[model samples]
Target chain A: MFVRLSAALLAMAVLATAGSANAQSLTGSGKLLLTGGVSQIEGAAGGGLTPWAVIGGYGSARQIGANVYATDVNTTDFDIRSTGVLIGLYDRVELSYSRQAFNTQDVGTALGLGQNYTINQDTLGIKVKVLGDAVLDQDRWWPQVSVGAQFKKNDKAALVTALGARRGKDTDYYISATKLYLARGILLNGTLRSTRANQYGILGFGGMDDKRHTQFEGSAAWLINRKLAIGAEVRTKPDNLAIAKEGAAFDVFAAYAASKNISLTIAYADLGHVVTRRQTGLYASLQVGF
Target chain B: MTFIALALLLAAAPVPGQPGAATTPVIATDGKLFAEFGGREGLVKIVDDMFVNVDADPRINTFFEPAKREQTKARLVEQFCVVLGGGCTYTGKDMKAAHKNLGIQKADFNALVENLQKAMDKNGVPFSAQNKLLAALAPQHRDVVEKPAY
Candidate 1:
C-alpha cells in the first residue's frame, strides 16, 4: 500500500516540475515545514499497530496545516483499533473524534463464560494552539503549545458486568498538553490524562468504586535534520485490572519524512512484562491534505 | 641582569606584526547575497513554492485565489530582488505604501514566514545563509506587514 502511495507522490512531484518553460516566477513567502518522528512519548499514541502519536495529531506540514488519522491495533488473540479524523481551522484550532475497538477473546474458552466477548468505544478530542511555531520560530525561547481533551465512551455491558465492572458505558476525560521546542532542537511534550477506565479493561474497571486513573506522559524528540527525527517517550498506564503489573513503558524510535505526502517511523518498545520482554515494530503512513 | 634579559626578549619579538593586523576585504555585499541565492532562478522556485503553500492554506486561500499567480510571482520576484540589492528594477510601490491598505494581520505574516521557511528548506539552503537573508529582510516587517492582518 505504501509503495503505491510513494509511486503516486513521486509521479505528482515530477509532473509539477515537468512544465519548466514558463516556470512560475518566485513570489510570496516560500517555506515548507517537514514532519516525521518515531515514538509518541513512549506509547501515548503513534502509528504503531496499536495507534501511537504519529497518526493522531496535525503533523508538521505547512500545506495542509491540519490533519487527523485512524488505525487498528491487533494483538495475539484479539483485535483493537481506533478511527478518528481532525481538521485544522485557520491553522489554529483542531477538532477530532477517535473510536476504539476492543475485541475480547472468546469468553467461553478463555474465561469459562457462556459466549464470545467484544466491545466498542469512542473518544472525542479537541486541540487548540496556545503559542509559537515549532518550525519557523527558532529564535524564541517559547515552544508551540497546544491543549486538548479526550472524552471516551464505552459500549458493552454484559461482558463488563460479568467481569465485575461498574458501568457498561462511561465517559473518561483527559487533558493533554503538547509542545515542540525548535531552538533546542528537541520537542518536549507532556500530557496529564485522567480517565475512569480500568487498567487494561476498557469498561470502567474495578466497578464504580475504583478511582479515576491519572497518568503522566513525557516525550522528547531530537531533530537530526529536516527529514529525520529520533525520539523517546515515557508514559504511565493504569494497572488496576491486574492484566499486567507494569507501571510505565519506554520506547525509542526514528522517523523519516520522505516528503510532504509520506512519512515512516520505527521503534523499539519495552512494556516491562513477564521477564522484561522487548516489542519492536515499524510504522509507515502517508498523509495528504490540501 | 633580569632587566637586561627582559629588554632583549621584548626586542626579539617581530615588532607586533607591523603594529596592527591588516584588515581583510569584505567578500559579501548586500548585492552578492541576492545573486548567491540563485539570482532570478532561485527566486522563481521560491515563488512557485510560496503559491502552492498559499493555495493549500485554508485561511488565506481566499485572499490569494483572486490574484493571477503568474503576475503575482513576477512582481514579488522583482520586489524582493531589488530589496536585496539585486540589479533588477522593481515596478511595485514601496513596501509600506503598497501594504498599508491590505490590513495584513499577524497570523497572515506568520503563515507567510512559515511558507518561506519551507521553500528555503526545499532548496537545500543552509540554515545560516537562510537566516542571513531573513535578517536582511526583517526590517521590512515594519512596513510590509500591517496589524490586524485579516
Candidate 2:
C-alpha cells in the first residue's frame, strides 16, 4: 500500500509542469521564500499538523496557483497516509481536499478487527484571507489572518458508529493569523479551531457528549535560508469520547523549499493517545505547487 | 489553554532593533548601523550598486536609459536617507509624480526589488535593517506598479 501510495504521489508531483506556472515570478513580488508555508496534513498551507493563515501557493494578488501533496507518517503503532490537491485563487482564497488513510497496524489485531484495518476519511477545506499581509507588513504589528472550514467524512460510517462516535461526519471551523519578521527570519502562526473529532476523525467526531469544543493550534519557524525552515507546531484536540481520552498533538519539524514549486517536510510528531498511548512517529510530506 | 496563550505570547514577542549579521554587538547598540545606513556614505553605496543592476536588468533597463545615471543615484540616496531616518531631507519629486509615465508594471517593480535585494546583500547590510528599509519602500508599490501583474 505504501509503495502504491508513493507512486501515486510522485506522479502528482511530476504532473505539475513549469509551463503551467504563469507568472515570471512564480511566487509573488516582495514575498520571501517558504512564505507559502508547507502543505498541512488536511491539505491547508501550513505546518505539518496545524494550518497557518497564509494562503496556499505562490500566486500573488493577481495570479492563480495550485498545489498537490502526499504524506506518510510511520509510527510505533500505526501508519497514517494522506494525499491531496489544493488551489489558491488570487492569493486570497484557497480550496483543498485530502484523503486520509489510518492503518491500525498491530492495534487492529488487538481490537479483534484482523490485521491492518484501515480507516479512511475525506476532508474538504476552504480558507479566505481576510486581513493584513504576513510578508509585506513585517515592519508593523499587523498579522495576516484568515477564516477557514474543513468538512470531514469517514468512509466506514457504520464501523465508526460502532466505535462509540456520535457521527461519521462533521465540520471544523477555524480562524488563523500569521506574522513574519523577515529581519529575524522568523514566522509565527496561530489558529483557533472548533472541532469534535475523535483521534482526528479516524474513529469519527462528537463522541458521547456530542458537543463542539474550541481548540488552538500554533506553529513557529525559523527560516534558515531561502530554501530551508525549521519549526515546531502544537494542536489541541477535543476529548469527548468515553472510550479513550484524546490528547493534544505537537511536532518538531523542518521544511525545505527545493524550488518555487516543490517542498519536502519532515517532523517528529507526538499524537498522544490515538486509540493507544503516546503514538510518536516520524512524519514526512512532499508538496508541489506553483 | 495556557499553553496556547503562552505560544501566542512567545510568537508576538517584539522584534528587536538589531543592526545585522555583521556585529552580534552587545551595546555597540547605539543604533550606529542604522545611522550609518542613513548617512551619505552608505546610501550612496547602496544606490550605486542598485543602479548598476538596473542598467543590466532586461525587464526594466529601458526605463532607466532615459534618465541620467548620476542624477538618479543622487536622488535615490536622498530618498533612502530620508526613509532610513537620516538627518537629510529628500527634495526629489513625490513618488507617484516621479514614477508617472514610466510604464512601471508589476514585473518591472518586482525586478527592481530583486536588484535591490542583491544590492543589500552585497552591501553587508544586516538582513533586519534591509527589511526595515524595504518595509518603508513597499508602500511605494501602489504608486510604482502602474500596470497589472506582469
lDDT of 1 by residue, A1-290 (tens): 33543454345434534654532321112223343222121122332322222223333222113333334333334444444444443334554555556555553356554344556765565555544444444433334444555555567666666656666555443333344444345566555555555533454455535777766667777767666778776766665544334346566766676654455565565533311223223323333332
Instruction: Please report how far candidate 1 places residue A79 from its true position, in Å.
Output: 3.8
- What DockQ class does candidate 1 belong to? incorrect
lDDT of 1 by residue, B5-118 (tens): 324434553442242221111224466667656777888898788878888886467656355668778888876676556667678666677667676653465567667768
User: How far in Å is the alpha carbon of A205 misplaced in model 1?
Assistant: 4.6
lDDT of each residue in B1-150, candidate 2, tens digit only: 433643564467444333211111121234564564645787788888988888887657888755477787788787776656554557777777778887675446656877887788788776667766765666566666554532
Query: How well does candidate 2 score on lDDT at residue A122?
Result: 91
User: Could you give the DockQ of candidate 1?
Assistant: 0.03
TM-score for chain B of all predictions: 0.68, 0.73
DockQ of each: 0.03, 0.21
Chain A alone, model 2, TM-score? 0.90
Worst 10 residues of 1 chain A by lDDT: A35-44
What is candidate 2's lDDT per residue for A41-151, written digit by digit as tens? 888989998888898877666655677888999887999998887777667888888889999988999999879999999999999986666876544576887889999
